[model samples]
Target: MDTPLKNLAIIGAGAMGSGIAALFASKGLNIVLIDPMEGALERALKTIDRQLNVYAPGGVQEAMQRIQVSPGLEAACNSDLVIEAVPENLELKRGIFAKLDSLCPARTLFATNTSGLSINAIASAVVRRDRFVGTHFFTPADVIPLVEVVRNDDTSEDTVARVMATLRFAGKRPVLVRQDIPGFIANRIQHALAREAISLLEKGVASAEDIDEVVKWSLGIRLALSGPLEQRDMNGIDVHYAIASYLYKDLENRTEPSELLKSKVESGQIGAKNGQGFYTWSPERRERVLREKSAALGELAAWLNGKAGGS
Candidate 1:
């Protein structure tokens, strides 16, 4: 039998790291959150505290008590699992993995919360490549249920199984990604849709708001319940094939980022983080949208959980 994962060490105290730490800690697992930057630990703890107060009010103190913040990498030495959520630079990740490889025990499982980096290359930095895997959690990790568990060529079966079990125990829906492909599963599909959306905008086919409305009412609503392939099967494979045959030739297949997006970035209108992008976002508008999205996701998460339980 495999050993149960009791303690986790997250090696970044940014949004993703803190969110992940809060998630495991709330599930009764001990977490050590480490970052070398000044005030990072305090900021992360504040964020975790605020999120817990909003979502799990009764368990805020208990969860907070389970997390220990440290400014050194050595704090992760005794952890059962170590997850690196650093910035998306290849060399930076490699450096961190090398340090972690030397500091952590041989039995410790190492996972990277990398979005699109090569898992094989990252695993190569560590001595125990077989114990290294990828655990890609979405933004607002505590709220999102989906986690892409990516296994590379050298990742052992035991490593995958243990990581999957731990994620499931933490109330996450972990999907194993067999290959170390760019963007993994979700982001690949998401970017395909985004590319087409931007293509339409660039060609003046429709306003961004109208396109968004169409997607939300049409594709988004259905996808909330059933996945694309499953929906395609229900709609009839023959019909899907016929539509694909006709539409495939005309679909957007650009290898480069859309000029519209580039221009937006050049002009410093880089979406909600700033003030505008494809759409203008005032501070109030951004807050309102975030609140609405959070509430909707919360409701959807509850519904999905209930559905899974019934099954």
Candidate 2:
């Protein structure tokens, strides 16, 4: 099984791809960043360097040397680990995995930097489903501390443990999720909140600004400390359960599945991912969002470390 990463490959040099590449390279690991074109890889390198410059302690320049930008897939095949950060399309991701499956050695760990997808389906194109795991990193991966290590039903204990160890070795909070589900872990909660957030906006219940304020400073803040389940237990499940029961019949039940969301997919408006959502984005705006999030994550990581007091 793949152990703590000695060398890593990041496929699809876009925002997430570059961020993941910067993450490993910043931690002193050799990273090969590959893209279908030289321009994509070049843009990814610029973004990665900018992020590392912001949060990277030694400045981005020093760490750029460890990052090998490759326009060719052949160079990436040498990695001990390959993280596919391609587009969210299943076929595209699976196609990349199939090539990686054939390009790399049997022992190399295969990971998808996907937020919400079926690992089994992705790995179906490859022979080793056990080695295939979800290594979901945040947008600015170099700075985010949380890395959800999702293990599917077919996954072995050793595979899960080794991936967890690798992330931990890179100073991440590698949270193990035993089951594979759509939007696993944080993203599930995010989608739940987002779905409702969209509902509130469409239903004229509140303005977008007000809704964000209420959640960001209230439920969103509290959720940072503990999840909904733990928070309910802390407050009282009976009371929480009662609230959910009422919500299911009232405000929550009143919510219609977003036509905008559906049409967006049909029309291809995949948020900042595709440059449109509830908000619109440009290349400049995308980088701005990433930079802001990365800085926040770096601060959060530092605070978490201090809170743990070096354990």
Candidate 3:
């Protein structure tokens, strides 16, 4: 039997890394959060404190105490599991893993929080390929419940099982990907929807506001309760099949990104960061929306947990 996970480490003190650390620490795991960049660790601690206040108010002090900030990978040499949550750069991640492979023991399992990078490619940097897996956590990791535990060709069943168990212990719902596909599961579907949404917007079929409203009021509510496949079953697979038979051809099938998105990037209208994209977001609006969204997500997560417990 595999040893139980206790000591965890997260490389990078960015938003995702800090969130992941806070999440595990809340569950009583000792986390060593490492970031070499000056002030990054401090920022991460503040972020983690805010998150723990929201997620584990009664135990904020205990949870905060569980996380130890560090400036180098050496501090994480003793960790049972080390998760790389750095930026989505293949070469950078590979270098980090190579260093970790040299410092850590053979028993230490490695995981990457890469959104869609090839698991096999990332694992190639280390000799313990069988112990490497992908633990793709969505943005706001502390709130999101779904985590894709991706298995590359070299990843062992034991590695996958242990990672899944660890994520479950931290209050996350882990799904085994089995295959190392680009974008994993949720991201691929999300991009497909974006393609269609952008295509419709470009064609003047509907205004951006209305298109977003339709998805928010309809699919958003429905998807929270039932996934796409389950909803298709509920609606009679034949009906969905019939719709797809015709609608499939009409849907966007562009192999590349939509021209509208490309043009926007060229024009420096890269959404919230720039104050404009599909919609204009002033600094105040961006701040307010993020704060509101975080609060709402926390409430929703609590409600979902309650529902899951009752069921």
Candidate 4:
């Protein structure tokens, strides 16, 4: 079935929300991006314009024409798809969905851009529970291809299909998360790696710089080409099993956040956004890192799209 997602409404003007708006606009869909905070709409418009130039330069004018900025929920009343990209707080999300439920049409699909919140809990606040789902887009939503389309118990198969189809139409790769489990799929795997990485740092197994180098130079590249499961197959199940049997026991199985990480945050060294975390960052250094990262991601995405068989 063709996607029924022409009138899209994104109810936030932050990084993820703006990126999503730019992404939809680039795909020729009319978008209404809403946020009530002063100057937020302006920022979102600028962000959309900037991202469009980077990702869809040839169509920037046309895409910008299709995007409208709003500071009110009423603008989304006629939307076919309403994606809530507000803060990750459950109460905040529930309030927005409740308000949207009253304002939007019954047929409008409601999706949350929550990274790890329970889809079921969020859907409970709205009457159209079956229409509620989660579309967890990664940072730089316009560039990232993977979107987790999460479903709650009340969600219908038709809702899932429509969301997947809509994402595919918008030039995204959507994966269905059948259950509303915590950390759904990618995040669960990500945190597993993070826990171990942080634990390694805490134990002085390696310096933070060296640890990152290992990840970026080694694990990150190979994992992009083939997933862990596929790699296990290639390495022989028996061999992997033998290693995992012993390795898993030695791996970090901490239920709590790493003390080393807690200490960094406690001291206000909260990464590039600030000036320090694992590494110190000057404005120039941060900008360079961001520029280099964006370039690398763009290159990787292009290579994957063109020659990686849509990996």
Q: Please tell me which predicted candidate would have the highest lDDT against the true structure.
A: 3
lDDT string, candidate 3, 1-311, tens digits: 33449999999999899989999999999999999998999999998898788768999999999999899899889999999999999999999999999999998999999999999999999999999999999878988888999988999988888988888888788999989999999999999999999999999999999999999999988788778998999999999989999999998999988889899999999998779989999999997887679879878877977986712
**How good is model 1 by TM-score?**
0.96
TM-score of each predicted structure versus truth: 0.96, 0.88, 0.95, 0.97
Candidate 4, residues 1-311: lDDT per residue as tens digits?
56658999999999899989998888888999999999999988887887777768899999999988889999999899999999889999999999999988899999999999999999999999999899999987888889999999999888888888889998789999888899999999999998999999899999999999999898898887889999889989999889888898899998989888889889999999899988999999997886677667877887888886786
TM-score for model 3?
0.95
**Candidate 1, which segments miss by more than 4 Å at Cα?**
1-3, 308-311
Q: Give per-residue CA lDDT, model 1, range 169-255, as digits (tens).
A: 888889999999999999999999999999998999999999999999999988888899989889999999999999999999989
Lowest summed lDDT window (length 10), candidate 2:
248-257
How many residue pairs clash per model?
0, 0, 0, 0
RMSD of 4: 1.2
Give the candidates in order of TM-score, highest first.
4, 1, 3, 2
Off by over 4 Å in 3: 1-4, 308-311
lDDT of 2 by residue, 1-77 (tens): 43587888888888788877887787788898888875898788887777777877575776798888777678877
**Local distance difference test scores for all models:** 0.90, 0.80, 0.91, 0.90
**Candidate 2 overall lDDT versus native:** 0.80
lDDT of residue 54 for candidate 3: 71
Q: After superposition on all CA atoms, how large is the RMSD of candidate 2? A: 2.9
